[model samples]
Target chain A: MMSTVLAMAAKDLRLLVRDRGGLFFTLAFPFLVAIFFGSIFSGGSGEPRQLQILVVDEDGSEGSSLFVESLDRSEALSVELSSRVEAVEQVRRGKSVAYVALLPGFGASLSHPFAGSPPRAELGVDPARGAEAGILQGLLTQFAAERLQDAFGDPSGLQENARSGLQAIELSGATGPQAEGLKRLLTEVDRFATTQDTADGQEPRSGGQGGGFKLEPIRIEKASIIVAKNGPPNAYAISFPQGILWGILGCTAAFGLSLVSERTSGTLVRLQSAPIGRGQILLGKALACFFACSVVSVALVIFGTLAFGLAPSSWGKVAVAIACAAMAFSGIMMFLATLGKTERAVSGVAWASLLIMAMLGGGMIPLFVMPGWMQTLSNISPVKWSILAMEGALWRGFGWDEMLLPCVVLLLVGSVGLLLGTKLFRWPNA
Target chain B: MIRLAGLTKKFGERFAVRSLDLDVPRGEVFGLLGPNGAGKTTTLSLMMGLLEPDAGVVDIAESGPPTDVGVRRKMGLAPQALALYQELTGRENLRFFGRIQGLSGTQLDERVDHGLEFVGLTPRANDLVAQYSGGMQRRLNLAAAILHEPQVLLLDEPTVGVDPQSRNHIFDNIEALKAQGRTIVYSTHYMEEAERLCDRVGILDQGELLALGGVNELIEAHGGLGVLTITTEAGEVRSIETENPVIALADWNRSELETVRSFEMERPGLERVFLNLTGRTLRDT
Candidate 1:
């Protein structure tokens, strides 16, 4: 029995290779789907989209420009510098999610550091977009902290200046060591204020803090992370598996069609007369289909990873995933073959159902972009489980246990399909 | 030897083969003669164990039943349609069937070679079945069935729609199998073919066996008369049936009939027997 089954599978594999149409659907079409879908999702950037924000610098000072530049450094936010009027009009017209304005004298506030009045920055958000509003508001505070840190670079120096400014405000200045500390701290502040004025292209007032105590301002120290915070997001990792599922769908359909073909061609009748059980014959054919689907799946994975740069994080899990998925689809093919008695009927119904599953399962569209309910409904599609298993094995970093759910679901579904198909299958023209 | 006792099959309310009883002794060529819609194919299917009998049993030699693997191993069947993977070469098809029949290695290769050569397809063994002519495909189908060399060969209209050359080739193979003392039960819609090859013939129609006997027995029991005919110079023709054509012609001449232009005799065979029994021509059905 085992030998017969192997012989049957070998025959089917040979036929698959020689059949151009079958090979196209099982192998080539998958890559086409992957390439096309990957291109669409990536938009040539190969990265997921980022949150957008507009920055309106009302002050036109060095401090305001520095703050906007800091916001630009964040990975999550994409900031566009615009005029206050244009920013306001853009946000009001629903063109931008929100905008920030840095008022005049914002640059001068840097001179006193923590001791002076806080920098005046206004964040305007659209009331209609509550999610965007909250996100932009949180990002504003983070940007503000980063801006302050870069501007001073010397935290202890800023704190000392702040203490001296407070003492000057109180008058009756400190005596002894504290008096000298205040004197030197005030001089640092005076120097910072001079730098600010110079940076703004304005003349420094000679008597701003008793004149001659102020030293010449040096360059403000800056530090930044020169490397990327994250790696490039590959759309092929997601699309390739979905494309492979398309091939699985095609493979299943071909298997389904084979049952019908056997009947029409009188091969089923011949097998019936052979010294074999009915279950054995059906199983042999189904095993052959399982092989076809698995071979096509592995081939698609290799092609996708090589040609399209879709790398699976764990090849072992990928092996298990493809096995389960192939079995599931093979069972589905048998079940589909049972639906219609003739080849034409079986193929028609199988393709229609498979296409629907593929569409819902993220073959044609990413599930992330789908509506919440559609995503939930897609749980019923076998293609969904197939793609989930593959993606998890690929970039999703799924371990053996992590990969179990989708594989189990696929195996169970496939087994059920096989059971139903076996139960319903009939000899041709009986 | 194959024996079917009250074998029956039904689909819903209609019976495909109703309580058929048949026995074909070892080394005998038995033909199932029937027309379209007859239960001949159904009976052969039951005998081959391709289908389950709703009512009775099929015994092959001393094997318990037709469905048993031990019995099926000793039986071969060739259906009317070409049962082959068209993409594979003829040799490949033979190898596949040979393996399924439990032949392997050198044994399988030898049998495949023998089958290909027997079918006169040795030269085209490497060509795809799809590329073969209809006649060649039919011959290959025959080869696949007999590769295992079963004791009993059950053929169901294997020559339907086949070219004359292929049909003759298939006929020769069947005859050769019988010469080898294999028990053969053949089924066909053509009465002439049945008469030429069968040692004993069973006529079936509408799921019932109407007649069963050797060619001579059937001709004697159901055969009516030999026809005597004469065409006069005046273009008048007259015909009569009798046990003796010579006596009928003597009577015609004694009756002072006009000068005959030509005369001919027609003999009663299986066709006439079918017509006499069923009141319908063999081709009409």
Candidate 2:
């Protein structure tokens, strides 16, 4: 029985080697899908992708240069300096997500902090990047707040700006009740700066801290919730799971088609008539599909590791995932074969069903990007579990207990599929 | 030896094989002659245990049932269709079947080689079955069937769609297998094939056995009578059925019957027997 089963599997492998269409779907197509999606996710690199933005410094002053430098150093934004015209053109053309421009008088206004037009700057964002635009705006605000902190840290500069502002106001206007109130505000501001400068490192006096008489600037500290080790090293680490899913889908369809072909061609009947149990035949088919899926998966992972820096955290866990995934998809192949009696019927039904599974399983779109409802629906797809299991070992940094759910789901689904498929399968001409 | 007792099979409302019984002695070549839908293939499948009988039993030399692995090991079937992997080379296909039959090492290699040579496919053995012509594919199918050297060989329309040359090659192979004392159940619609090859022939129609005997025995029993036709110089034609066609022809010449012009005689054959029993030509069905 073992010999017969081995012989059957060996025959299927030989056929697969010669089937060009099957080879493409099983091996080449999945690689292409991985590279395509990986490029989109990682910008084709190991680092997390940054939103590209252009900066136009019209003043080119020390303050404007400082602002540009701050934006350039941000982890979320990749900044490039350009002319205002060039920056606007790039944003309009969708080349950069957004651009920031600093007009003249921006450097002079930086001294007053809140007195004049508040460091005049223009933000031009690509309309399509509404979400990213909000992030960019918040980052610009944070950098501007740092400038305010620099102003508060130097009380002498604040006093000099207040004295200049009061002299200008007195020369431009005659005295009235409103003028008297402005004059009172300036006198108080001038007094506050003088006291802060004289006090030198002492805590600010209590009472006049409100109404533009500030004490200290607010600073925001940022941290990421996701642990560094738990995230993927590159997009390939994430995309390769989908790639393996594609390969498994291909194996399922190919083996399913082969089973129907054998039935229609009468070879299956011959095998049944041989001195082997019917169970041996089904086992032989399942083994062939499982081996094929495993080989494709391992090859894709190796290629991804060598070419794209995809690091699997645990080899033992990787083996578990691959074995379970292969088993699940092989059983799917059996069930698929039993769906129809003819090759054309089986091929059409199998591919359509697999494509749907692929769509739901995060093979077409990443699970993180899916809508909440779709993500919940994906739990039912074996593809989702297969990819989840693979990702857990590869980059998700899942411990053994964390990995148990997807692995167990895969095993249970496989066992059920194999049982149902074998039970429902029929030999040809019977 | 093979035996069937009240073998019956039904598909939906149609009876595929109805209450069939027969015994094929060891070393004999038996023919199951029928038309396209006459249940011959279904009966062969039941005998091979590929399908279950609705009622009755298939006994292979009284070694229990054909469903037994030990009994099945003694049988080989070349089905009506070409049951082969087109992508694999002929040699690869033979090797696969040989392995499935539990042949290995030197024995497997020798059997594969001999099977290829036996079917005259040795030269094209390395070529993919898809690349072969229909005749070559048919020959390779036969080679695969005989790779295990089973005691009983069941061939269902083995010469289907083959050229005359390939057909004769298959006929010779069956003869050789018979010479080696293998029990063979050969099925075909071609009566002449049955007449030429089978030691005993069974004629079947509509899932029922119409006649069963040697070719001569069937013809003598159910072939009716010799037919004699005479066309006279007066443009008159007469068909006379008689026990002796030669005697009838001599009588016609001796008579003053419009000065005999041309005469012909039709002797009883399997076709006549089939027509006599079923009242329909084998080709019609």
- Per residue, candidate 2 scores C-alpha lDDT tens digits across A265-294 of 889888888888778888999999999999
lDDT of 1 by residue, A308-427 (tens): 777676798889999999999988988999898788898899999998988788777866545547877888998988887887777655557767888999999989998999899887
- Which window of ten consecutive residues has the lowest lDDT sum in model 1 chain B? B251-260
- The segments of candidate 1 whose C-alpha lies over 4 angstroms from its true place after superposition are A44-233, B250-256
TM per prediction: 0.77, 0.77
TM-score of chain A of each: 0.61, 0.63
Cα DockQ of the candidate 1 complex: 0.58
Model 2: runs farther than 4 Å from truth? Answer: A44-227, B229-238, B255-264
Residue A384 CA displacement from its true place in model 1, Å? 1.4
| Clashes per candidate, residues 3 or more apart or on different chains | 0, 0
Per model, the share of native interface contacts recovered reads 0.73, 0.86
